[model samples]
Target: MSKVSAFLRKKPLIASLMILLLVLTAGCSGSNNASQNTGKNQVVKGGTFVYGRPAPVTSFDEYSEITSNNAFAIDKVFEPLVAFNKDGKIGNWLAKSHSISKDGLTYTFVLRDGLKFSNGTDVTAKDAAFSIQQHLIDKGPLAISAQVASIKAKDNKTLVITLKEPYTPFLSELANFSNGILPNNFGGVSEKQFFKKPIGTGPFVVQKWDPAGDLTFVKNKYYWQKGKPYIDKLVYKLIEDDSQAINQLKAGEVNAIESLPLENANELKQNAGTGVLTSGSWSIEQLFFNTLDKHFSDVHVRRALALAIDRPALTKALTFGYAEPANSLLPPAILYNTNKTIKALNFDTNAAKKELAKSAYPHGFSTNLLIASGNSTTAHLAQILQQAGKTIGININIESIELASFRDRFFAYNFSTMINGGQADYPDADSILAFQTDPKGFSKSYWTHYTNNNVTKLLYEGQKTPDGPARAKIYANLQQILADEVPYIPLYYPDVLIGVRSSVKGLVVLPNGSVRFDSVQITK
Candidate 1:
């Protein structure tokens, strides 16, 4: 076994041991029911909440380049300039108001005074400017936002941002926790130190992180919100296995978990009193054919491969009908042209054989299917593809590697065919395009290595325009181009499932396709 795989294998046992100790010390039930029952109707005071999370965090530094789980965890401890309102519109959070210049080059931000960091430092425009510049300094993962040309502090309560160009999606970018404002005294830290010891300005303070077990957060007494964050402490336990996570929730060891398996949903629903469940949009699995590869270089071969596999069957078997079969490159639920000509290629084994015969090899050639290791869903999907490919005389050898290894290999164009799953970074269609089309020509980052001149132009135009209607049209055209290019074959869009405790209330879904835990409160 590889080092990562070995570590992952050992991690669960360690977590279990830690959990056992917590159970022994804290008692079987996590509830302080005596206090809770008496004060149930009164102002929310405090109670420690232990919860289960589905994935392993790649990093804890809110500003560092890391995985999605890293950002999700950071959101709990960081404050952003603006937050998504109920209508999914960007509303003021740290900034009281903001305006873009007529030319769209400069953005002026009016700050809310008297806001203090967790350390009691007054949040000022200089702090905002420094936080923005930190991204450009290669100090942390926040370096992704180096696209900003200048961030100037107009005054103590006012800030002005000058962009390299008219970035239409800048607001959506700001919504990312990586852009969350840090205290002025917060020096840019190394990537290693950043994750190990993270400090942020948010509603909670990290009390402890037992690396092998749980991360505990106490409610920030100095939180900006008035008489809020009713819960005393939030405890996040790292339970790697779905079965174990569900078991903990049922046993009342943990309060909630994300991405619950659909197969177990019915069983959990049967015990509705103990487990409360909800679903939202989060992730999609896709088949990425390396266009740089000689075999997939042909459009007909790509189309034929698309036709051979049965997405409906795969979805039913893997996702228990909880996911929508996605044939189009653009997700069906996206705000773009819903009636666009993008449609699923039908499952036809005969057609696939005919297409293969027309190619240089009358018999289909063998290829390796690379997948994220230790992921059951990807393995299941690969098995389905292998069975379907056999019928079409296309032999597929499946290879499962750890995510970190697979990402490095795939980005280097070392893998040809892979079952790649992409989670939507933002609710926007532009986020989808960043993965497929490569106008820069065979990018190591773009696994598809897809090059389309027309699509590239449309993407540029879309990024430049601030008008929503015009932007939609641009994305609509790009989606059609994507359908024609076929860099990625869509598989399924899985509905995000979350299991929460009965007493937990106000657990609303964030627009970024994650749960807003800050808004959650555990009632008596």
Candidate 2:
């Protein structure tokens, strides 16, 4: 059984209590809406909104060190220094204004005066600097602070950051939740148990969290925003099954869904009067091969495998024709990506056979493809690849396991090949850089155990330089290297398909690919 299932089984009574609370809360929220008053098509102030998420958050307090779906979910309750605006521009949130030095190695931020955390503690420059320090010590995802020479508080109002090298993506890192400013003097839990209770400087406060089912958040009375967060509370339900999630939306049990399956996208689009469907580019879903594996270690075998698949057909079959065939690691329209020189993977069965003959396995060879359980999308892609491989006399053995187990397996290099979904948490080439080499002074996610020194040198150069043109040239060259190596075959860029209730308005679809719930208002 999965870790989550085992946890629920351990605390059956708590699970039962949460179920009872859910029933009562749902009943109250539903009935309370009838008598509550809100603007005609504008936001309401009293009602609570129920939302459906694919999986429950594993940790709420383990900020800066871990990345998960719940990271975004919890961020709603905790604010960030900068946010991706509707037009994909980085806008000021906690930091009222900011300025960069002429050399591009220093940044000075003017905090929004009179800001306070949900705990009523005043937010200061020390809070912002300390948060960044915390991430560097833990070697978190936003660990750019090591290169950061110093972060000094000019006063209670101004915070300055000085980097050893020019780093343009520092702004993008600040936009992440890890850099979110919390009260500097706050201390309560051990490092390991910190996630049990998380305090933030956002509009909502976590009132209750039932690990097995849902987490509840109530509006902070002292929120910094002016007349915002129309809803009184937010509830996130853990509904792994798509059918159950869709049923809950149709039944008005949940106002919004985390994601809508591509098969249901058209149906939801047709019902515009009651709800709407929105989509945008997510990260690249690619086929990654273990470079260290004996069979795939051969470049000829890797090239043959890449040439064998019919990517167009696979894209159509897996995404229901709602995705674009990927040509590079970074999304096409994402900021700072200029890899237009790269070309898509062309299907060449005859060429594939020629390359296969050149390899030791002239007839064919079998390998296992690892897939995440409960994710039918990855399973479908695996099946398509299996069929395509058979045409070239290559046999594929597909294996499926839940995300938790899959995480351990993928990290341990337990599989020869795998299909995985990578989300660009922030919009930049640096987001895709995680999957590349183990660059010095950087966090590594090169799970395929692939590395190239030339690519590594370019990545480091691009990271330290602040010039856009120079960085673009380096990234393009890096992508070209990957294309030639075929370490990970670019599959397709999947759409962030979503279903929204018609009663909800002001819910702008962000360019970075996440739901903007703060602006969302119920109009029923």
Candidate 3:
């Protein structure tokens, strides 16, 4: 057995700590009554909410596609076993109650009585088991089926899942949108047919869909949550242009839009008729170095590049003081943060030059910096890096490509350096750490091709250790090592800027960029 497994076996207190961490990270539930009024505002429902999305949704099937745009639309139709409430607590949705075994390897879930899908079919434990099996067969980008050793449906209402090993973040992972349950016997449905018409047990049902246009939804009359989903109709209008969306919001063509540019959001905030919401986002804009590239193979070269750019200035210029400079992959507010201050790589041209001299290329070299076109913020960030590189005697050529092409090339490891955004599927630190650092994980090629046996061991140990001072110490050491290794340069954690019409009430934007419309009401 590994040292972590041995430690877990010896320490009885670790199990309690694990439960507490799960609760802290998963978020708490609200009232059982979904339609309970806030008491602060009289919810005047029965209105059509025109929501503007920045991009067209690629697929309605969460199991097949992973995109924020798709999630915004799917959240209305599909209900996960557990969901994060507005307060960011894990709450029972499809499952009425759940329990974890003392050994941390078994999970039992009881389905809510009278649960039914949009088509009036019962949502049983067998359906949940089918969903897990489908995830395993499909092997989607966010699939977690490998974690399960076996899943058994005890009855129509009971499900028991046995894990291959102890996974601290299992509950939180189940709360992800990708794990949303599908109906039983859905294996025969083709991917194309499922994307065209997907069924779920959520508050709304798909009414109509127009490709590259607006997708409309109507309240599910038979929705399990009684008197909820106050809005009569919800429409997601695809507007690819940011400026055009802002103009629509100003002109009262749209009720709400998320992820607005910082500058535009600031301007909307100044308008009396506009309501702007800004909160620390789970997303981070970062620069990932291709460690396999000869130019960045040397640790000194990567360190020099990390030290050359100014993160604070970039945050201010790009997010207009709405974001905080990132010191580690896990945000300080997250439950896993150690609070130990690690020395950050500050911008210093002289220091960067000195570090570069230690590399094979004493006189620095040239490389291309890849970025997605049509993103003004990333474009400006690339320009700043270009200027910083000149000061350190390195020539950086900025290359902007279509978003689709950029994603393809990035995952294929075709770039020397790439500026992009990444977020954990769940609130746990293991989500990000495992994806970015686990050498045997699914995202190994997509991330910086960094391989360190010691770091890998530390990461695995951190996952097994319960949330406490010991776990904190493990993560602290990991962060310090990553900071020195410089596989990725942490930039800033951007704020989720959202603009809403002043009359739209009870709309809450979560830190993870999910907009809650359960209690939303429109007042003309």
Question: Which pairs of residues collide in model 1?
Answer: 64-141, 65-141
What tens digits encode model 1's per-residue C-alpha lDDT throughout 315-358?
A: 88888756777766544544553323665576888887887777
Please identify model 3 stretches exceeding 4 Å from their true place.
1-41, 338-340
CA lDDT of each prediction against the hidden true structure: 0.63, 0.64, 0.71
CA displacement after TM-score superposition, residue 142 of candidate 3 (Å): 1.1
Tell how far residue 48 is off in model 3, in angstroms.
1.9
Better of 1 and 3 by lDDT: 3
Mark the 10 consecutive residues where model 3 has the least summed lDDT: 1-10
Which pairs, if any, clash in model 3?
A: 26-90, 27-88, 27-89, 27-90, 28-89, 28-90
lDDT of 3 by residue, 367-392 (tens): 99988676567778899989988888
Worst 10 residues of 2 by lDDT: 8-17
Name the runs in model 1 displaced over 4 angstroms.
Answer: 1-30, 33-44, 85-87, 139-147, 188-195, 210-213, 337-340, 358-362, 373-376, 401-414, 438-446
- Top candidate on TM-score is 3
- Which residue ranges in model 2 land beyond 4 Å of their true spot? 1-41, 62-65, 192-194, 272-274, 336-340, 439-445
Give the range where candidate 1 is weakest over 10 consecutive residues by summed lDDT.
10-19
Residues 1-524, candidate 2: write the lDDT tens digits.
Answer: 00011110000000001000000001212324332345564344557777787667666653543344556555666677776554445678888999889888888998897888777778888888776666666664444532788888899878898988787677766775555666553445565554566667777788888866798888777778866666777888888777787777776778777656667766665654335444455356777788778878777777787888887778887787667777676666565543356854468999888888888888988889888766567667788889878878889999987766776786577889887755555445665564344534232334567777888788778777664577778888887777777788888866655566666655555433445556555655
